[model samples]
Target: MQAPINIALVGNPNSGKSSLFNALTGLNQKVSNFPGVTVDKKTGIAHISPSLKANVIDLPGTYSLYPKSADEYVTYEVLINPANADKPDIILIIADASNLKRNLLFCSQIIDLKVPVIIALTMMDLARKKGVEIDLAGLERELGVPVVAINPRRNKGMAELKKNIELVVKEKHAPARDFIDSNVLAPDAIREIKTYFPSRSDYAALHVAVNSEELPFLNDGQKQGIKQALQEHHFNKTKVQAEEIMQRYARIKHIMKASVVETDPLQKQLRSEKIDDLLLHRFWGYAILLVVMFLLFQSIFWLASYPMDWIEGGFGALSGWLSQVLPDNKISDLFINGIIAGLGGIAVFVPQIMILFGLITVLEDTGYMSRISFLTDRLMRQVGLNGKSVMPLISGVACAVPAIMATRTIENRKERLITIMVTPLMSCSARLPIYTVMIALVIPDNRVLGILSLQGLVMMGLYLLGFFMAIFIAAIMKMLVKMKEKSYFIMELPVYRAPRWKNVGTTMVEKAKIFITDAGKVIMVISVILWFLASYGPSSKMDPVHEKYEKLIVEHPDQSEELNKAFQSEKLANSYAGILGHAIEPAIRPLGFDWKIGIALITSFAAREVFVGTMATLYSVGETPEDNDATLRQKMSAATWPDGRPVYDLATGLSLMLFYAFAMQCMSTLAIVKRETKSWKLPAVQFVYMTALAYICSFIAYILFK
Candidate 1:
């Protein structure tokens, strides 16, 4: 069997690169991290011919060879660093046909790297609609590479693309000549560098001279040698880069004139532009955005309620059945009270998670997500960030680990840091379970004006609160973190298209699966551990309760059921977990969190959603067999302190939700922050400040609501 051909799919942002990868690989893909970095690396297997398969790597989208952010650096490393393990055997550059001139500059640079290249021109339909025409044969002849027009979304041109891939591999097709002579920019430096790296082309060696310090693959000796050579030849790096870009554009202009034609250079606005006029209007845009957000939060509750009820009921029945059938042994208790209860807690939220991810996917597919950035740019600038930070902050609502990684697109260091520090304040999907459970507990389900759900309005308010607080924190950080580099926001708004229902469905399923597999594992393990702690204690403490309960049951045989309930409560208060929870109770008492809630707060640091599972487990451990039919929410609602005050009252629920919104609870997020900033200092400071903020906010919320 032949080893798979390594093919890297390179393209600019919004150039249909992701669509092409999905089309080619279908379900044969998996996402992992790039080697030694937190950036996502997507790779998959695509069959080019019956006898051959290609390992397709979807590298991060980048504009040019010059790298600024971490994401661009990953792409630059894979393409330019020969020692990179994932280096491609062939480069398939996906270029947007409608924006050919700008895309061509990147294409030309890749061509000069001497890799076998094939140009996949996407958005040709859009190009044609915009009065642009391209002669494919002429383009192929001019660029000295195979150029194939493809529409990956509709599966058009897949056969031709596959055929071209096969042919390119067979012939080892590379560009016939340099796109712009690199040696002309720095003749002496290029010549000297090539002698040291004889196998490299002049263009590749020139890059080494220019970016030696940034390139990770280069050894210290090579870097020093390259610097010495550049100095000896008096090679001006910035000037050479400028000259290279200018020269490439000069040639690209000639190519465009020869092979491409625009029917009207100044055509009327596109349909997208016409729509943007109304949708992007200053007054209407924000109103529309608010309405959109309101509907999104409302839908999460309204749509998922049926399935959530069904799931909750199913778990309740299952727990009841297990308690009755299982032999009342320790193992049975573990299954019923520990694993099953924990699984039930997290599993019930799957419907809501799917709804949230699915809606986010729709916004992205329709390109309205970019409009959001544009709409919020002014507000973002006021917070020391630009529109670039909005996407990451918005993404934080789904998950913070990837959201923090998305901050790589922000080039300004101080702005990026501020974005990272504040992003966790956004209530993420993990917190969705917390918010949903809490709101349903304390907030009324009644509709205001007989039309809008009060619960939904409160949900929206919580989300908005997080957003506003993020900006407020960003503003403060702006005043604190000192940096002089000017920040600017530049982005291209993609044309709106109908949401790809298939992609949206796929994302919904994938996110749900991730929630189950990744978070479920943690919840189940913690649930079992907590059950053990809550069920047993030091024999010295436990034996007294057992003796007291047994003696009382014998004395009052007629009221034995009531006595048993009292005994169960006494046992729980004396259990190992109870002692642990008690130790932290004083610190949290002002925030309305009892010892049980303290245990959850401590355990949920692993992940925010674990708070639900921890409560389920703790409550299950204390419940009598008759209470097994009750849901977790029911169990929590009935819970009370020794003084008889309900534990999950309005004040407690609100305080708990506030704490989660502000606190840095997820260890994974902290780890990613450390990796991204490449230091422990930032993450430590972030954890401290966020925790402090959470404590303060939670204390205030408890006081006001209590």
Candidate 2:
């Protein structure tokens, strides 16, 4: 079989490129990192024809070929770097019709790359609504490239798009004309670089001359040669870039004037603008944001309760049945107490995780996610960041790894660093399992205003706490980290649209799968280890517990069940896990953590969600055979300290929640942090400061609640 032809999808942010990619690829897509970069590379297989299956690569959305951030650099390298492995055979530029003038800047740049290019025009309805209309033939004639109008959302014009793609690939279509004269910008520099890169167009050579130092494909010798060539020509890259943009826009203005018509020169305000007037109102915007957040957090509990209960009960019955039928041996103990118990703990929270990601997806699909950045810009600026920082912080709620990677978009170095440092402070979904279980254990299930759930209110409060604390830390870091650069918040608010339910559903399912597959592996391994440690101990200590329990059962035959319970508890306390937990108990006791919780604390350094699984496994191992049917929550609620006080009361529960909130407890998070900052020192300092803060805050929470 022949290799699939590579087609790169390129467009500006929110230009409907992703939707088009999804429409073309359907369920064939996969996400991975761009070869050496952390930026997500989304690719898929699209059958353009029965004979032609294309490899569709959705490159990072960039406004111009001039790269600014890491993501933009990836797109630039893939296009301009001669040696890049995934370089496209053709470029599919998705242009937003409603904003054709602004979108043309990027389209024109891509066309000038002298590659096979197709313009998939989208949002024609949105354009017509804005009183702008374009003649498709004229647009194609002006740009000298094939232009296909498409509505990926409604699945319109896709057949024509596929047909055009197949035609272009088979024939090796290339743009007939350059949109702008590249020689006028830096003639000598382009001529000099083109000699070394004989096949490269003048435009491509100009870009290479301008960005030679940063382009990864160029060897040191080539870079030095390019540098010498540029100096010999007396090339001013910045001046040339400014001039080139001016010339392109001037030409674009003429093309728009000729091919486009507006029914009203002074058009009425768009429907989106009218709605934004209300939704983005100074006071109302913030108020609506809070209400939206409150509802989102509340819905996590309200919508997920039924499914969560079903899962919990299902696991309980499974454990009971396994206990009853499985032969009484260590193998059965490992299966029931180790594996099933741990898996059950996490599986029960899948509903909440799915709901959280689904709702977040809804926010993004409707375009309101950007409005949030707009609203938070003023506040973020006060904390030494900008609106761009809000995106990463908000994404942190989903997972810190990608969220931290998202920080690469921030152009300011100091702001980016501070954002990366404090992003983990946001309560990610991994903490959801911990939060939900803790809130259920401690907070009342009653309503606060005769309708709003008090437990949900507490859940919202915990999320708010993390966000606020992150802001506070960013403020402090701003004063300390010294890098002098003027910062600006420049962003275009995308018009709101109805939430794409398909995309939302896909996201929810994708994120849930990631959660289960990634976190489940760790939980299963830890659970088996914990079960062994909790089930067996030094034979000398184990023998004593067995002898004492056997004697007590004989002496008091009526209380044989109680004697067995005591026997299990005694054996567990002297077990390997218990010994490790006891070593840390004295240190954590002031924060209301018992030896078992201390065990969880150590194990869960692997992941915050692992705390729940660790607790489930420990408690399951300590359960008497008669208690096999009890839920993890029930087992935990019935737990007691030596003095018989409930182990997971309001104080301890809140304290544990607060600790997880501030602690750098996730090894994955730390690893990503190191990757992002590219420094072990930053992550080390992050771990130290966060752990200390967790300890101090947990102590205070325990004191106040107790």
Candidate 3:
């Protein structure tokens, strides 16, 4: 047995590093956090040969050795600390061939770390589209390292890339050329640094001298020594860094001139720029974005309805058939009402989740997602959020845990905190079922202006409502939270390209699978616990109902079925779940929620999606066998108060929808918020504020409409 070689895939942001990683690793990848850090670290296995396998770690995107954010610092940390677990034996730097100059800066910095290096040149097709050409051999000669042109998205030049990796790892081929004369740059500091860390390369020693205070690997005495050395040499950190960059660029300029032929990629606003001209126009871009938002919410219903119906019908039939065949006992009841109902609740929404993720993925693949940030920069600033916050907030429409995690890219502490606090206010996919069911029950299915769906219009309105609420809250936070640090938005807009269908399909399937499996596990457990609570109570307390039902069954033998259903309903109302729901009933009564809704609300803190499962199980357990075939929507619709007024009329439905929209119902999101902010205070404040808002809004809606 042989240990796989450790290979680090490093590159600047938007340099196609992800494309290369996907090509190399395929589906054999895992995501975990770094030790003692919450930032995500992705690692995968890449087979290079019969005997050679590589554990390729996709390092964080960084432009230079000087890190600015937590993500970039992770990259720099791993590169400098040899003892780190993700330390690489070989480094493959993916560079955008079309934007070689900017990409080369990072490459030059990495090469000086004295590791075996290979340049995986991507975007060659884009380069050629702009009438540019690259001399691969000439580049290899100029850089003193292997340079392989690869189109990872198309799997082009992968074989050569693998060959280069094997060659570099086997030969330990360090770069033979140095772009900067380090001795000339800082002779005294370099000499002093190497004396303390004798094994460090000249460039590595120079870095230690420059960043000793910031580097975790350096000991206090070594840091003090480096500081002393710097002071004795009269070294200026900024001045030295500037000179180093200038010298490296001077060398890079010559290399690029010799080996690369440039054409004016912006000569006539290529197709991508042309599209951006309209999509990024000061006036039309905003309008187009709003239209896109409207269509996305509408399609979540229109496209997902077919599959949702099929899944619901299939599950309902299965539940009914199982009830018919299996004897009606506690075990059977638990299986049908608890596990099956819970899983089915989540499964029914799988289509909607798929559609939502697919749409988001499409926008990302088309490069329009970045344009959204560009368009929203000024608007976001007015609300005290960075433009980068817009992506996470919009992505919140899919989920908040990831969106909260996405706040890591916001370098400004105050802005990042504000984003994490307000992101959950944006309606997520978990809220879809609530919104969809409520809208169908309340909002009409008729068309407006003959081209728009009235029900869908409501759905879009809910999403917009959340977004506007986020901005409004952000504005308030902007006024409240004091900040000393400045924030800026720097993004590289990827050129437009046709969506890679294979990758898109893979993402959709993978995301959908994750959603169903993850939610299914949590929901099933919660449903089972809920079922037990709803099915059984203190025998002392429930004995009377049982005796009453027994008497009714004997007294009216011809009506045994109706009596039995009544008995079960009475038993549930006396059960533990019922008692708990009743305890909170008064608090929610003004907002139009009954005891059953209270139970759902309490159980849903584990996850917002659990509300569906809770409702399904609660209502299913209370239903007569004759109505077993009815869908959840049908059952909910047929529900009524004791006075015969419908329980789920327009007012109650809209109130519930608005409650879920604004509530901080997901525990996962809260935990992530706590982790990102590193304080329980923020999550506490967030939960309190959101819950209060949801209640107030729901109360207002119920008052106005009822």
Candidate 4:
């Protein structure tokens, strides 16, 4: 039996590290927490050859070894702590070739750590297109380690990369000399720290001296000793770091001079710049942004409809076929009505979600997404946020939990807090099903200009409404919070290129799988519980309904089928779900929702998308109405009040949609908010304020439209 070698993949953000990981691990990766931290740890098996295999751990992307945020801290902790389980046997450093100078600074730092390292130069294609040429062999000789040029996106150089990795792991090839003169710069401090970390490399000991307080592996005694050494030596951490960078870059320039060449010394402007000029124009930029966003929503509707309908019809047919194949019993009912119906509700929306994520990924791959952040900065700054805040806000359209996490990148505490507080106001994908169903019922599909869909226009309008509301709320918060801090926005715009179809496809698939595995579990459990509640009632209420149906069936055998269906509906109205919904019906009636809708509102506090599954269970699964052929949309459209007025009329549908748009209905999002904010106070306040706003807006909507 052979033990698997451990490989650590580390690189800067947007350095093609993840692409390489995906290429190596494919679908074998497992994502979980790293030991005790909430930061994600993604590891998978990479088979180097027939007999050699490696375990690859993708560390969080970091700019340097110094710890700044939780992410960077994790990367540093794993690398420096010898006792840590993830300390790799070998290191693969991904360096962006297009920006070789900045990339090599970190590469040089790692080389001094004396670990077996193989450099993988990514983005070489883009570098070549920009007239940048690198001598791979010269780079290897200069760095004193094996360097392989690879493009993970195109599957280029994989065999060579694998061959190099195998050789490095077997041969134990590491740099023989330090890239920087650490002994001359931090001589006294490094000697002192080495007394404690006796086995550590000189550079590792120096890092311990620089940031002993934040490193978890340091005991109190070691920390006190390191701090004392720093004080006694009069160590200047910043000045030392600056000098180290200069020394590394000085060496890098010598290396680049011999190994690199640029055909165009006068930098040629890329097509990306030309596009940005028009797309970032002061007035037209915003107008163009509005159009792009509108088109995104419109495309979701136009492109996803075919697949959505196919999924819907497939599920409907499956439900019918399963009913015929299995005997009519509680198990059958659970499978068809409870699990299938609830799952179907979620499955139909998968197309829309995938489409949205795919388009967003394409926009990101082509470099347009950064331009959006650049364009929105001015407007965002006016409202107490800067341009960087726009990324999280825009990302909220997918999910608020990660969107809030993204705020960690904003260094300004005030701006970050404001962004976190107002980000949930963006219409996330969880609310998409509710909006889609309601819009289909209330808004006609007729196109306004023969090219624009009215339903899509409504969807776009709802999204814009949320954005405007977020801005307004942030401005108000800025006035009330009394926060004063220096803020700046620094961003790099990547050169425009054709969309990387493989990357886009990978993201689309991953997102779809996440939704099914993550959100589907929540929906399934809630559905089963709701099915029980809606399936039974007190014996006094349920027994009589069954008895009356039996008596009516014998006397009027010809009408027995239709009569029995009606009896079941009557029984369900007396069921526990009905009782609870009716209890709250009076209070919600003012906002235009009835008892059934009230039940959905209660269950949906767990997640916004659960409203669709809840409705499916209560309407279709719980009552197997005579019109079993109809879809959820059809059933809701067919629903009528006691007086024969449609239940899903324009006013009622709009009211419910608006409620979901504004309300803090997702418990998972609230929990994430508490985790990120480190307090229950903000999430508590957020829930109260959002619910109040939802109610008030829904009340007004019902009054005006009904």
TM-score of 1: 0.98
Inter-residue clash pairs, candidate 2: none
| TM-score of candidate 2 on Cα atoms, chains taken together | 0.98
Model 1: lDDT to the true structure: 0.92
Q: In each prediction, how many residue pairs overlap at the backbone (N, C-alpha, C within less than 3 A)?
A: 0, 0, 0, 0
Quote the positional error of residue 679 for candidate 3 in Å.
1.3
lDDT of each: 0.92, 0.91, 0.88, 0.86
Per-residue CA lDDT of candidate 1, range 1-706, in tens?
Answer: 5779999999999999999999999999999999888889999999998988999999999889888888899999898878789989999999999999999999999999999999999999889888999999999999999999999999999999999988888888678888888878888888888766553578888888888888888878878888888889998888999999999999999999999999978855799999999889999999999999999999999999999999999999999998998898889988999999999998999999999999999999999999999999999998899999999999999999999999988999999999999999899999999999999899989999998999999999999999999999999999999997898888999988999999999999999999999999999999999999999999999999999989988998999989989888889889999999999999999999999999999999998999999999988988898889899989888888888999889999999989988999999999999998999999999999999999999999999999
lDDT of 4: 0.86
Task: State in Å the error of residue 388, model 1.
Answer: 1.1
Query: Which whole-number lDDT from 0 to 100 does residue 451 have in model 1?
Result: 87
After superposition, candidate 4 runs with Cα above 4 Å error: 317-336, 543-566, 621-625
Instruction: Report how far residue 107 has shifted in candidate 3, in Å.
Output: 1.1
lDDT: worst 10-residue window of model 4? 621-630
* lDDT head-to-head 3 vs 4, winner: 3
List model 3 lDDT by residue over 1-706, tens digit each. Answer: 3689899999988889998999999999999988867788999999998879999999989888888888887898888887788889998999998888889999999888888999999999888877778999998898889999999888899999998887887787789877677778888888888877764368877777777898877788888888888899998989989999999899999988999886664544568878988999989999999999889978988898899999999989988988898897889888888888887888898888888888888889888899999999998999899799998898899899888888888899999999999999999988988887788787888989998999888999999999999999999999999997788899999998788888788888988888778877788888999999998898987999999989888989999988987787788889999889889999999999889999999988988888899999998888766666678888889888778899899999989999999999999999998888888999999999999999999999999999
- Superposed model 3: Cα runs more than 4 Å off: 263-266
Q: Give the Cα error of residue 196 in candidate 1, in Å.
A: 1.8
User: Candidate 3: which pairs clash?
Assistant: none
Ranking of candidates on lDDT, top first: 1, 2, 3, 4
